[model samples]
Target: MMHPSESCNHRKSLFNTMNRFIGAVNNMDQTVMVPSLLRDVPLDDVGDVKTVTDDTASNGSACFQQDADMYSSYVLLKSIRSVMEWGVLQGDGRGKERVGESEDDDLEKQFHFHLNGLHAVLSKLTRKANTLTNRYKEEIGCGNL
Candidate 1:
């Protein structure tokens, strides 16, 4: 049977970016059977995803309701994937940004650029999902799953 990644010849199927993202999100959902287990657990790289650091506080509190907890991280990752799925359904927001998108621009070039961006972001999200799953296991004191 053919894999779903080959459904669309994405960049000549050199990078199955969408399939990877969907797989990552699905795996995360399956591994994280109990969402409550991830509550209050701090992420490893808090600095990389501090969305909006509090400027009013002297102690420099972080965003996502003060701390970047595992539960929040899970929610954020899922939300992003959801948004991307929705974007696919509604078509890409190319004209909405309007940075340098002229009619003369090479469509293939733009497709490759966005495909590369998706690959990078999806790879990071996949890593974070796997890390969070491992952390959850550790939190529960289980060595192997």
Candidate 2:
């Protein structure tokens, strides 16, 4: 079992990291505006404000979703890598080599397996994000504005 002090330290670290991420996400909408392709941005009208809001909300939500998904995938991959690295360091990586279970040999196979799964998820997310981006571009409604 983890000592009380160790547990408290771990919790504090997690909370700090989480707070930073939350702060960034909360301000993302204002930071991300229309693309530079539209140089004639009109901020003088209420209509423009409405359009910007709609576009920003959609795009920001899509971005946050993609970021969250990718972060989760990255976390999973890193966790697996850390475990494998630790096992290698301990010289007990091979669960049962004589039984044809070579750790080094299977490492690549397992890594690829996990990587392929992550790739599939990221691919889907990219497609979705691209769609959202395209929609935002369309909302800009400026073929040459």
Candidate 3:
């Protein structure tokens, strides 16, 4: 039988965070019908991938200039979801890199730090996806999201 601790660990794994991100992206894809409206619409932090990904109410409207657009964000979201499923180095790099015992402490600290960042990014992406869907609905004159 699987240990309870192991089960709990699995829930907190990066895979879990990735799964949630995928779901949000999938929903965004389905909700967006006229994607042309999303084109050239500024968005993100990275040049081609820049925009706001906050989980709270965003100031992202079609009014101001930004980095990426909703369309690009949508595409990026889907691409990331694909990568999580297919994984990095899908064909190779399956072997593990063992860390020295002396580095274990640093590794643990780094892992937690990166994990927290991952959680924050995922939350932002999920919120962005939902926001895009809601915006599209509003454009189409749909009921309250």
Q: What lDDT score is found at residue 12 in candidate 1?
A: 41
Could you estimate the TM-score for every candidate?
Answer: 0.63, 0.28, 0.61
Q: List clash counts for every candidate, in order.
A: 0, 0, 7
Candidate 1 lDDT tens digits, 16-84: 665676677777777787899888788876656535443312333222444679998778668667756
After superposition, the stretches of candidate 3 with alpha carbons farther than 4 Å from their true spots are: 1-15, 42-65, 89-105, 143-145
Candidate 3 C-alpha lDDT tens digits along 80-125 = 6676777655333343556655555688888889898988777777
Give the top-scoring candidate (lDDT).
3
- Computed on alpha carbons, the lDDT of every model, listed in order, comes to 0.66, 0.39, 0.67
Compute the lDDT of residue 84 as modeled in candidate 3: 70
Model 2 is weakest, by summed lDDT over 10 consecutive residues, at: 43-52
For residues 17-133, could you state the per-residue lDDT of candidate 2 as single tens digits? Answer: 344333433332232263343233322222211122333245332222222332322233233334433543333334434675657777888887866665554444333333333
lDDT of 1 at 109: 90
